[model samples]
Target: MNQDFVNNLYDIKGKVAIVTGATGALGKAAAWGFAYAGAKVMLTARTQSKLEALYDEMKAQGLECAYQIGDPIIESDVDHVVAATVKEFGGVDILLCAAGMNNPKPILEQPTEEWEAIMDANIKGTWLYCKKVGQVLKEQARGGKVILVSSTRGKLGMKNYTAYSPSKAAIDLMAKSLACEWGEYGINVNAIGPTVFRSDLTEWMFTDDTARTKFLTRIPIGRLGEPEDYVGVCNFLASSASNFITGTTIYVDGGYLAG
Candidate 1:
C-alpha cells in the first residue's frame, strides 16, 4: 500500500481512548498501554479508589490520563462516562469495553440470577457503551475503534463456564453485527478472545494445583498468558494499523484453542 499509510498505521498519538473496567488488571494494562502510546486515556470503573490510584500512577509517569468511577452495568453511569470524556477530550477515538464478570456453574445448576448478571454485565453493558459512544464517533465524522474483551470460552465450549461463555459468544457476534452496520460510517468493531491470564478473577484457579495443571495442559504453548501478553494486540486493534480490520475476533489464547 501507500508508504504514508504504512508509516502512520500504528501511530495513535493525540488520540483519546476510553477504557472501561480500569480497576481490573487487564483493563489497567490496556489503559496504561494506550497512555504510553501517547493517547489521552479516560479510565472508568465502579471503584473510585482503584481508579484514582491508577490515574495518579499514570500521571506520575507523565502519561495523560483521567478517570471516572461508576458501574458499567448502569446506563446512567455509561452516559456520564461518555459525556465526561467528550467534555474533557473533545471526543473519543477508541473505546475498550473490558468490564465483565464470570460465575462458573454447570448449565443445569446455574442460578437464573447469576445467568442474568453475566448477560447484563458482559453483553448489555458492551452494547450500551457501543451505542452511546458510537453515536459521537458517527456524528463527529471520524471513524473510531472499538475493542470488546471476550474470552476463549466464547469460541470453545467449556464445561462449567455456562453463563460466562454464552455472554462472551454474544459479544463476538455483536462485534460482527455492529461492524456490518457501522462500517459505512468508518467505524470498526472487533473483539479479543483471551485464554487463561493472571488476574484477580483467575487467582483462585491458580491457587488450586489441579486446576492450574489442567488449565496449562490445555494450552499447546505450554504456559499461561499474562496481562502484558495481550497489550500489543490491544494496541494494534485500537490504532490505525487496524483501520481496515473489523467484524472479527482475534484470539490471544497462546494455542489454547488449537488443541
Candidate 2:
C-alpha cells in the first residue's frame, strides 16, 4: 500500500469526540490530542471552573473544543452530555470515558463509602456514558469508537488498592462486552491501560520518596509515565487506524506489565 494511504488511515479531521473527565490529567491529554489532530472535542466534567479553564487553555492553542458540566455518574447528566454534543457538533463519532477515581487503603481500612465512590465514579460513570453514546452510534449507523480508560491495576493486584483495582477490572471487562455487542454496527470498544502515569492522583509517587524508587524497579523502562506519552495511543484509537481493533486493552505502560 502507498505510504500516504497508510498515513491517511489515522486521520480524524472533523470527527466529534465526547470526553468525560476532561479536566483530569489523562483526560486533558486525550482531549488535546484529539483536538490538535483536527477533531472537534467536547469536554465534560463536574466542575465548571476547571472545565472552562481547560477549554480556555485549549482555545488559546487554537484547538477546537467545548465544555459541558456534568457528573459522570449521574444518568441524567450523561444523557444531557450526549444531547449537548449532538447539538454542538451535529453528531458524535467517538466517545472517551476518562472520569475515574481511586482511594487507596487496606481492605479493612477501606470505608464502605470510599469503595462505593470509587465504583460509582470509575465503573458506573463509564458505563452510563458508554450506554448513552452507544445508542447514538447505533442510531447513526456509521460505526464509531468507544475508548474507556483502564489501568494495570485491573490486571495486577496491589496493596491498599482493593477498591480501585476492582473498579478498573470492571472497566476492562465492560470494554470487551461492549465491543462484542456493538461489533455488528461497526463500533469499536477498547480500553487503554496505563501503569502509574503522571496525574494529580499519582503526584505522591513523583516526589522524592521510597515508593517512587520501589515502583521504578517494577517498570522495565526505569521511569514513570508522563501524560504526553498517551497522545499517540489516543489518536490511534480515535481514528480510522483502529477500525479493525476492538475488545482489547492497549497497555501504554513503560513495560511494567511485561516484567
Candidate 3:
C-alpha cells in the first residue's frame, strides 16, 4: 500500500461528530480534537455557557462546531440533540459519549440519591445517547463510530469509588454489546478507559501532595494524566484508522492499570 494511502486511514476530514459532554473538560478536549481534525462537530451538555464559550473559540479558529444544552439521560433530549446535529452538520458519522459523573464515597456512606445520580449520568445517559444515535446510524446504513468514556475504576475495586467504578464498568460492557450488535451495520463501538486525569473532578488528586504522590506511585509514569492525553485516542477512534477495531476498552492510563 502507498504511504499516503496508509496516512489517509487516520484522516477524519469532513466527518460529523457529536460529543455529549462537550462543556466538561474531557468532552471539550475531545470536541476540539475532532474539530481540529477537520470534522464538523455537534456538542451537547446540561450547561450552555461553557459550551457556547467552546463554540466561540472553535469558530474563531475557523473550525465547524456548534453546541446545544442537553441532558444525556433524557430520551427526548437525546433525540433533540441528534436531530439538531443532522440539521446543522448534515449527518452524524461518529459519536463520542463523554457525559458522565462520579461521586466518591464509601459504599455505606454513599446515599441512595448519589448512587442513582452516578448511574443515571454515567450509565443511563450513555445508553440513551447510544440508542438514539444507533437508530440514526442504522437508518443511514452508512456505518459509523461510537466511542464511550469509561475509567480505570471500572476495572478495579477502590475505596470511595464504589458507585463510580460500577457505573463505568457498565459503560464498557454496553459498548461491547453495541459493538457486536451493530457490526453488521458497520458501526464500530469502543470504550476509552482513562486513568486519573486532570479535570475538575481530578484536581484534588493532582493538587494534594499526599494524594498526588499516592496516585503517582500506582502509575509507572510517575505522573497524572492530563485532558490532552485523550485527544489522540479520540481522533483515532473517530477516524478510519480504527475501522476494524471494536468492542474493547483502550486504557490511556500512563500504565497505571499495569502497575
Candidate 4:
C-alpha cells in the first residue's frame, strides 16, 4: 500500500452522505463539514422549512447538498428519505445519525413520556436510518460509513441525565452491533461521543451557573466543546482513513471521559 495514499485517505470527494436531524445546530455543523470535505450531503429533519433553509444555505455556499423532511422514528419516513437520496444522488456512501433529544430529569422524577421520547428519537431513529442506508450500501455491493452521534452521558452516569443517558448508551452499543453485522458487507459503523457542545440544546445549561460548573469540572480541558470541534473527527470517520476501523466510540468530549 502506498503511504501517500494512506495519508490522503481522509479525502471524501465524490461520496454521498445522508445526515439526520440536519435542522439542529450540531447536525447542521456536521452536514457542513461533510460538504466541506467534498461529499454531496443530503439533510433530513422533521421540519421542511428548516431543512429547506439549510439546503439553500449550503447551496449558496457553493456546496453540493440537498434536503429531505421527515420524521426518523417512522419507518416509512426513513425509507422515503433513503429512496429520495438514492434517486437523486445515485447511491449512499455515508450516514450521520445525529437525530436525538434530551430531557434532563432525575430518574425518580422523569416522566414515562420523557423516557419514551428520548428512546424513540435517539435509539430507534438512529437504528432505522442506519438500517435503510445500510441496505442501500449492501445492494450496491460497496462498503460505506455510518457515524452515530452519542454523548459522554452514555459512557458515564450523571444526575438529571436519566432519559438522555440511556438513549445515547443504546446508540453506542447499536453502532458496535451494526459494525459486527455489516463489516463483511463493506460498511463501517462507529460513534462520536461528545460532551457539552455549545448548541441550542445546551443554552440552558450554560446559563445555569451550578449546572455549568458541574459539567465543566469533569472535563480536563476546562471548557465546553464547539460544533467545529467535531468536524475533523466526522471527516475522518466518513473517509477511507477509517476503512479498517469499526465498532468503536471516539470521544470528542475534551477529556471529559478521562476522569
Models 1 onward score TM values of: 0.96, 0.97, 0.97, 0.95
Q: By summed lDDT, which 10 consecutive residues of candidate 2 come out lowest?
A: 200-209
Write one digit per residue (lDDT tens) for candidate 2, span 168-194. 999999999999999999999999999
User: What is the model-wide C-alpha lDDT for candidate 2?
Assistant: 0.94
C-alpha RMSD for every candidate: 1.4, 1.0, 1.0, 1.5
Candidate 1 lDDT tens digits, 100-215 = 88888888998899899999999988998999999999999989999999999898887898888889999999999999999999999999999988898778887898888888
* Clashes in predicted model 4: 1
Off by over 4 Å in 2: none
Whole-model lDDT, model 3: 0.91
RMSD value for candidate 3: 1.0
The 0-to-1 C-alpha lDDT of every candidate, in the order given, reads 0.91, 0.94, 0.91, 0.90
As for model 4, its CA RMSD to the true structure in angstroms is 1.5
Question: What is the lDDT for 84 in model 2?
Answer: 93
What would the per-residue lDDT of candidate 4 be over residues 1-259, giving only the tens digit for each residue?
A: 9888977899898899999999887788889999988899989999988888888988999999988889999999999999999998999999998998888888888889888988999999998998888889999998999999998889987789878888888888999999999989989999999888888768888789898888788888988888899889999999988998999999999898897
- Lowest lDDT sum, 10 consecutive residues, model 3, at 198-207
